[model samples]
Target chain A: MKHNFGAGPCILPKEVFQEASQAVIEFNNTGLSILEISHRSKEFEQVVIEAEALVRELLHVPENYSVLFLQGGASQQFAMVPMNLLPEGGKAAYLDTGVWASKAAKEASKLGNVEIVASSSDKNYTYIPQGFSVPSDAAYFHFTSNNTIYGTEIFEKPAVGIPTVVDMSSDILSRVINVADYDLIYAGAQKNMGPAGVTLVIVKNELFGKSGRTVPTIFDYQAHAKAGSMYNTPPVYSIYVSMLNLRWLKAKGGVEVIEQENIIKARTLYDEIDRNPFFKGTANVEDRSRMNITFVMDTPEQEAAFLNLAKERGLVGIKGHRSVGGFRASVYNALTISSINALVDTMREFEEKTK
Target chain B: MKHNFGAGPCILPKEVFQEASQAVIEFNNTGLSILEISHRSKEFEQVVIEAEALVRELLHVPENYSVLFLQGGASQQFAMVPMNLLPEGGKAAYLDTGVWASKAAKEASKLGNVEIVASSSDKNYTYIPQGFSVPSDAAYFHFTSNNTIYGTEIFEKPAVGIPTVVDMSSDILSRVINVADYDLIYAGAQKNMGPAGVTLVIVKNELFGKSGRTVPTIFDYQAHAKAGSMYNTPPVYSIYVSMLNLRWLKAKGGVEVIEQENIIKARTLYDEIDRNPFFKGTANVEDRSRMNITFVMDTPEQEAAFLNLAKERGLVGIKGHRSVGGFRASVYNALTISSINALVDTMREFEEKTK
Candidate 1:
């Protein structure tokens, strides 16, 4: 099997993928393909309920926080966040860390005033900016915990009392996080969860039923929370696969255990990059993401050669984003330590060959 | 497998569902589940291209139109339609046939002035309102082609110069449709195409880039048309299954052939309902949906018993929506003739036993 490190729509546990595949064909031995089963059916209702309940158990989510599997991904949440929370003349604070964070801020700008509390753009977004205070007057403070493109992660959550919103797409399940730290948390379920369609939104109920604008029915979080995320036919297959992955997480001893393993996998590859002469790490060492490890070869020709070499070693999706071209090894929760070892071994062999 | 007539997240062809399930396990033998594959990968790009191509080929979509596989289903489109097409201070004409149509109009009312040009709510939405004129001054004339809840359908296009928008969520692809008759058409993929997450939107490019509102990036048609539906990581599994289902539709001799089968299936059920003293169809004969066939038993107790009998016969999802509860057998494009026959036979057996 190839070592998959492609960034979000990244790795999922093989067992989870297999179970999901089985469920697709015959869910709970209902003799109905998961795809064909009605979302309103009792069986699927259990799937939704269990998925939500698991999220609460895993995250230790406080009471009154709602867990929703919504469609349109996190991209939709960019607009929805502002549409629902930011009133007609409201202002919100945003941390501009990377492409996605900037995109989220931009979406909010179209709806209302968006104040950039901090940004790392001047430094090519290699590290998360720190020491910038969010205004209490702002409607909410939004930040992305991990940057997939730039390979930076905020190791420390902003210690503030303001309502915080974090887009934890890439690093959601790979680590243990305090659910009570943020008022709202939205993550695209592609990485560290299940697939690309459904977005997981964990929002506090205190914020619900209080939007100032005439929020579109689908964009309104209060409406979704009230209806239990079934205001319409939800993305069934995506949500079910997510449920299977969550089950896998629980079986693997939950987030704390997985987080330690993820740290180990990342350290192995980063240690190799630091020791090897032919390669250089990209992101600042302190803020480098454990999930997405970015590095570069000595030259473009060397980088090109190493990519093919990695591919030959059954390492796929090691090629990095074009904006920061080199390599990105996304070691998500599902990527095994052996896969990271394989990638590290390939890197060392490539260096020897070049020398 | 059971006869899946559940109103969407509905039935898909067995072959298509099987193929989709297989793909979920290992897509293209990449050892990566289609669920876990990166949307940026060439393999997935091809899936998206081929799916869009299949849509164009099967529907004879015009060169000037853009086909999008979007998330958020049709409920989001209720707001998106007006957000993309309805100008500021503009008014649009809406035909309030049933639940979905009214929901669409209600969403539009939040954005701009909505004229309820015609409504069948006066008759409990059991028939499509006819002989109503569309206002030329309106920005668009919007309607739902089929109402899954009430078993009503609009058979004829509005004879108006205004742009036409149809939410074909329940009946799309079961019959042939003229591409030029409507400027834009959107359908949730669940019923006639694939599943509940991905929505199919075919919009004329000419009508785009003309909207007066600053549509949220996710809601803007022009933005999606420009990106070719890759603005976000799409509902990958849903779109891929839709492609597989669309391919099946083409192999089955396209919509024309399927429409004929649908007609026959509906006829058999309607014939049985009309001939027997036990049941009666709810919709007016001329406007009753061929897609969703709604019927009621002579008494509430008999209705309960018939549902039990239908379930006992390995038949399912024949329960009517609560709004007009009795039975709603939604025979979409993927529902087979044999399944219809099974439903008919069960009805006859129940009727004879009760008598």
Candidate 2:
């Protein structure tokens, strides 16, 4: 059997994709394609409303927080968060974890002043910097929860005194968190939640109304809040599929249960890498991600051989990002424990063959 | 048979959605879910490259033009077009045809001097304004090609001496046009295309490097152009479904054949409205849109009864925008001729019963 470890647009529950395929043809027996349904209609509105509520309930978001199914993914939010939340000429603090954080910092700098509080890029982001100081007077502090490429994650969310924005694009819903602690949290749906079109944004209502900027209605959190994420034609199919995935997650038990399974999956593969001398892991062990596990062979030649042999054995998408040349096995929420075991077995087989 | 007349997030061809649904699961038997496939993979990259080529081929885009897939819909472009293309303190001539045009004007006004060349709002946008003049030294002349709410369209695109930017969100790909005439053309995918979450932007390459403003990377057409629309994690499912729709359109004899069918669909409904004294067609005949046809009754009683009766008979989503205070039948490209024929039959039955 083949195991897909593609770091995202990554694995999704088979049942969710199946139900989504069916919905595309006949949405709740409406005899109309989901694509054709009006966003404001009773049926479609239920999707946005229920999806929002589920996100809030699952994450334990406070009543003051508004959940939005926005378009443009987390990359867009990198700019929009600063644009709508930052007061004109305001300064924001950012932690440079990896590529995503760097991109966020660049976009935020365009709208207002952004100071990089700390960066692990000096060591090629092989680890997440700890104990960074956020500016007291900044608009907000920003950080990426997980570095997908570098295979590092801040297991514990940093404590920022001021309002905070976290890009949880790669690791959201994989585990439970204190939703009330965050002022704004956005996740691109492609990785752990759903497909690629929708970005889930949850924001504290009170933190807004301070920006004093005329944000384009599409970019404005208040506009999305009032409309319940249906201000314009939303990513209907994507959101519907997200609803299905969330439902699946709830059925398998919510984030808390899934977090246990995720821990088991990550540990199984990491143990194999640690005990086996044939493969060397990339990121610092303490800062390693439970989702994306990056590793390499003892030599470049062995790495190439291992990749080819693994592909021949139906293990696909194990190649790491070019910036960090190695192999990465992304075991997201939908990644079964069996898939991780298969990778570990594949690695063991490679080791025996090389020996 | 059920007929959907949603203004947009509207109907697509039955086969398009079916094929798209299949791809979500298998996607060329890659054994990985489409969601699991890497965007950098040759398989998915080919999908985007081919989609762009198909768009260019269908539009007969000039060699100087490049097709790009973007996020946040046309609403985002309302600001981005000016932000990336409009030089600092430069004046842009805008013809406000309807709601969308006014939105574009509002966004452009934020960046630079906006000269309102003409406005059809004097007639509540029920008729298109004629004999408009563009500023001789304007940056570009911007207008909405089809007003979804107002049911007015520029049947013949106006010639502006300066560069022209047209929001063809509603009627795009339904009719043929000289793509080279406009410097930029953008269309949201939900209407007459495939789905939400993807916006098609076809722009003249020469138009860039003229704007002095340091636009955010996501908002810059050049940034997307350089990355071939993979500058960020694109709305993958949306784009893949769009490719399916485009392929289906091509298989069904391309735009020319579909355009004729759209004309027949519009003429059928418009003819019924003109013959029935109970109905009053809203837009002027010369400016009436072939896509969105708006009409109303003399009394609120008639309007309420008509809507309820139609709903009972499996006619869904025909209600117009509340701002317009009437009914609208949006005959996008995928809307079958038989659907319009059924609506006309329904209209006739209603008129006879009332009389």
Candidate 3:
């Protein structure tokens, strides 16, 4: 079996895939493919309801918060967050962790004034910037909780007095979060959630329409919340598959259970990286992501040789981002311990061959 | 045999469904579900490229145009169209035919000045308004090619002096059209194209970046076209299935062949509607949509009775919009003429029993 270690749009449970695949042929015995059913139909309405309920139950999202399943990835959210939160001429504060974080800030700057609260760019984003003070006068504070490219994660939410927005695209659902902490949280549902078409948003209801700007109805969070995320024909099949994946998560004892397993999985692989002479971890020791584990070798030839060996042993998608030129084994929620063991074994084999 | 006539996310070919279902489990023998594959992978890149190529081939799109597979459906396009085409303080003309048409105008009004060139709302949008003069000074003239709810269609493009844009969400690919006639042609894939998560946009290359307003990068057509619709993670499975559906259309002799079948299918059903004494067509005869045929009975009791009979005959989603309050049979590309016959037969059966 192939061990998939791809970052975002990553692996999902086998059972979830099977059930989703079956629905594509005939959904809930409705005599219609899930792809063909009307989003407004009672059957599909149930799918959306259950998907929302699953998000609520698993995350313990507060009742005051609205959970939306929207189209356009987190990239779209970059613009939308600023449009709905930052009023005309208002300033927003942002922390630069990596590419995604800086991109978020740049989009916000196009709409209004933005102050870079802190940045880890000095070290090539090898760690999350700490002790940054968000301006109290700013409309809202925005940051990326997990930097997929840099393989770093913020375990603790920054307590900024103003509203806080976080892009949790790569690490959401792999670990539990107190949903009440952040005023708004959005993630493109490709990694720990489900697939790519849909983005998940959990926002405090009170935050809706607070900005004086005349946001386009489609981009307005209040419109979506009032309409129950059926603002228009949502990413139907994407939402359905996400519901299936969520069901699988619930069956496996929710995010808390998954988080424990994730810790062990990351530790097992990182231990090997530290112990192996030919390999080295890329990110800071404390900030190293439990989701995407980035690493490298002393020589380019050694890295190339290990990648070839890993491929021969059925490892897939371990190649790192071009910015960080080695390997990134993304161990998401659906990645089994067996897969991690397979990678560790491959690394050991490489070391023995090198010696 | 269930004959689905849901407006959208509507029916697709059984073969396309089978292949799409298989790919969800194991895409292209890569040991990864299409749902799980990275959008950046060569495998999925090929899926996007092939989908774009198929659109170009089937639509006869010129080299001067770009075919984009995007998320957020036509609703997102409602905003993007204006954002990309209408410059700051520029006036745009719109034809108000139905709910979607009016909604498009409403969204454009948020961005800039929008003038209603013509409106059929006076008669509950039963006919496409004709012989209306578009404002020559307007940046663009927008209209709905087919009104799904009102059962009306504008078969010929109005030669408005300015740029022309059409929302072909319900009828795109059911017939052949000259792509160069309109500056932009967009369709939510659910109806005739593919599924709900993705939307198809065929836009002229030169039209990009004309809007002087700082359109958000995500909403900008030029950014999407430059990146080949890969500026962000796309609706992967939706694009894949659409490619499969397009392949089916090509093998069945392309849009020209489908158009003939669609004409005959519509004619056969309209013939029954006119011939039958119990049922009466709703839309103006000359403007009745080939995609959705709306009709009603004299009494509410008669309509309810006919609906029950229709349901028992294995017909689904034939119920009309709540506003229309009768029946609407949406016969999209994948809907076989045999299914149309089933609907016609059901209508005939109702007449025989009532008589």
Candidate 4:
């Protein structure tokens, strides 16, 4: 048996694959493949509408927030968020957690005065910086909910009275959050949501058209919101698959129930690492990401051995990011507790062999 | 039996769908779903690299021209092309054919000085406007290769002495063309390529960085081109489907073979539309798009009856744009000759009933 723990574009529910595969052949009894359907037609419009509604329902988003299904990953939102909200000299505070946070900060810097209020980069982002304060005059406070590369997460989101924007690309739908707390939240549908082509953007409608700079229509939140996310042809198949995944999430007790299962999976593996002397977990204990668990061996030789052995035993995508080399097991929402148990068993076996 | 005629997010080949379905279940004998693989891992990277290389090979693109797999569809490129290539305070010329052309023109107007050098809007864009002169000092002359909504195409791409950018969203890969003819060519993957979520951008490296405006990194063509389209988590699943489709295209006598099939399909339908007194062809003969065939009846009652009959007979998406008030049969690359024949038969039957 194989377990998939790749970070983004990671594991999805089996039912989603089965249903999406059938849809690819024939969609909605229309005798047309989902790939061939028109986005404007009533059949596909239902898809767009329901997908948006499900997003709102799943996240418990308020009526004031507009959920947009867009293209480009979270990287696009880094630029879009600032382009639509920041005036020429307006400042937006950013909390730099890791690679994605820095990329977002870089994009915003070109649009306006991007103030890096707090950054975990000083310590290579091994922990989420805490006690950061947002500027009262700032347009918005942007933060990455989960850092994939560094295996860190903001255990407690900062309270910024102004509009709060988050790049939840890696952790969306993995846990529940107060949708009302955030003015805008965007996530690339790769990790826990659905697929790679779609990005979900939930924004407070009242926060738009404030940017003095002429924003591109495609990048403007208002343009997408006004068109109901159909300003242009959206990522149809990806969005559909996301809808299926969201349906699965709903059926599987929604975010509230899934969060407990996720914690169990993450805790089991982390506990094994803590007890085993040969292996060490990365990230500050409180800031460690429940979704992606990164670990390293005491020696480089052991680390290489473990990775090769893991792959041979049908355990995959455990190699950590090159920037922070080690091993990473992404325990996303789809990752079953059995998979985590198997990994714990592998770790125990390797330790026994080494001893 | 259903015939899909939507301009984009349109039809795809059966074999491509079959292969994609299988891959979703088990990719490359890994026993893991394609969604489970890591993009950074060698396995997934091979897929991305090979897909880009295949596009370059199929188009015969020059070494200097970089191919970028981006998100946000070609509409994003409408703004990005100008934001990345238009010099500060610089002017650009555009040929407005239909809705998409006007949309791009509108976006460009917001960025810099836009010259509507030519427009078929005078004639409700029933035909492509020819004999337009582009300014030598202008950054570039932008035009839509095929107007999906209006059913017109500029078959012989205008040789504007300045840099030329074309939105090939509707007819890309339908025929072979000199990749060097334009400075930039972008197509949304849903039409003739694969599915929605991925946009293919082929651009000359030298023409970039001319726009003195600070382009948001996501909008910067250079950033994507330099990174070999891996600047961010790309539209992985969409691009993967595109690779499968392109591979199928290459196997079926490449673009040259598909072009012949496309020409035949368009000719058969247009002949029926022109010969029948009950219907009238919408586009001028010289500018008729081989990809999208538009027509209308003498009366709205007859038009509604024809559409209703067509839907009852398993014919779909043949209704025209509301702005145009007619019927449009989008004969994209994946549209079979049998489907067009079916549409022609439907038209003949409708003509017989009305006459």
Error of 2 at A276 (Å): 1.4
- Misplaced by over 4 Å in model 2 are none
**Candidate 4 residues A218-303, lDDT tens each?**
88899899999999888888889898899999999899999999888999999999999888988899998998899988788999
* Model 2 chain B weakest 10-residue run by lDDT: B32-41
Model 2, docking class: medium
Candidate number that wins on lDDT, 3 or 4: 3
Chain A only TM-scores, each candidate in turn:
0.98, 0.98, 0.99, 0.98
Candidate 3 interface RMSD value: 0.8
Q: TM-score for each prediction?
A: 0.98, 0.97, 0.99, 0.97
The candidate, 1 or 2, that scores higher on DockQ is 1
Q: Please, what are the lDDT tens digits per residue for candidate 3 over residues A39-117?
A: 9999999999999999999999999999999999999999999899899999999999999899999988999999999
Clashes of 2: 0
lDDT of 3 at B156: 93
Which pairs clash in the backbone of model 4? Answer: none
Instruction: Name the regions of candidate 4 deviating beyond 4 angstroms.
Output: none
Tens digit per residue, CA lDDT, model 2, A230-316 = 777788888998998998898998999999999999999999999999988999999999989999877789988999888987888
Listed in order, the DockQ scores are 0.81, 0.72, 0.85, 0.76
lDDT of 1 by residue, A1-355 (tens): 7889889787788888788878777889888989889998999999999999989998888988999889988898999888878878889999999999999999999998999998999988998887898888888999999999989998778976678899998888788898888889999999998888999999999887455788778888988988898988999988998999999999999998999998899889899999999889999989999989999877888988898888899998988898898999999998999999999899889878878
Lowest summed lDDT over 10 consecutive residues: which window, candidate 2 chain A?
A207-216
Misplaced by over 4 Å in model 3 are: none
Q: Model 2, range B1-355, lDDT digits (tens) per residue?
A: 7888888888888888778778777888788767668887899999998899888878788989889999888998988888878899899999988888998999888888899999989889998888888888988999899999989999787877899999999999999989988999999998877788899999999988678888778788998999999998888888988888888888888898889988888998999999999898999889999999999999999999999888877788888888888799999988888888778888888988988
